[model samples]
Target: GDRVLATAILDRVLHHAITINIRGHSYRLKEKLKAGLVRLEETATTT
Candidate 1:
């Protein structure tokens, strides 16, 4: 009953789930750099 319904919902969610692994610069920082709000040298030294 409840357990069966929960299992069905979880199964459907897992079926549509896709794992993502992201590795890159921050999009916000990139935008800032493009807008001249952030400096390339500052990011290089901070990280």
Candidate 2:
């Protein structure tokens, strides 16, 4: 997308909207972690 057009579209859509900034990993990764399929570097090192 053109930067100018993208900015215009974003400006229009967000004119009356409230935005939230979410932090950290996504739910899918969390699920994988809980299921013992995904591990953080520290966890993998320990095990």
Candidate 3:
């Protein structure tokens, strides 16, 4: 993956951006989780 090349692009994209943290289960994955089919671990997002 061209992560290094994309870093500059991402920096510009996030500049002056207002981010909101939305915590809670995703309704889209509700059925999957209930069926024991989805991942339960929480992974940190890349900056």
lDDT of 2 by residue, 1-47 (tens): 69999999999999999999997777877788889886876455544
On TM-score, the candidate that comes out on top is 2
Q: Give all TM-scores, in the order shown.
A: 0.45, 0.58, 0.51
Candidate with the greatest lDDT versus the true structure:
1
Ten contiguous residues with the weakest lDDT in model 1: 16-25
Put down candidate 1 lDDT per residue, 1-47, tens digits, no spaces: 99999999989988979867777678998999999998998998775
RMSD to the hidden true structure, all candidates = 8.4, 6.3, 4.6
lDDT at residue 30 of model 3 (Cα atoms)? 70
Off by over 4 Å in 1: 1-21
Candidate 3, residues 1-47, lDDT tens digits: the string is: 69986998889998999988988766766776687876566322411
* TM-score-best of 1 and 3: 3
1 or 2, greater by TM-score? 2
Local accuracy by lDDT, each model:
0.87, 0.81, 0.70
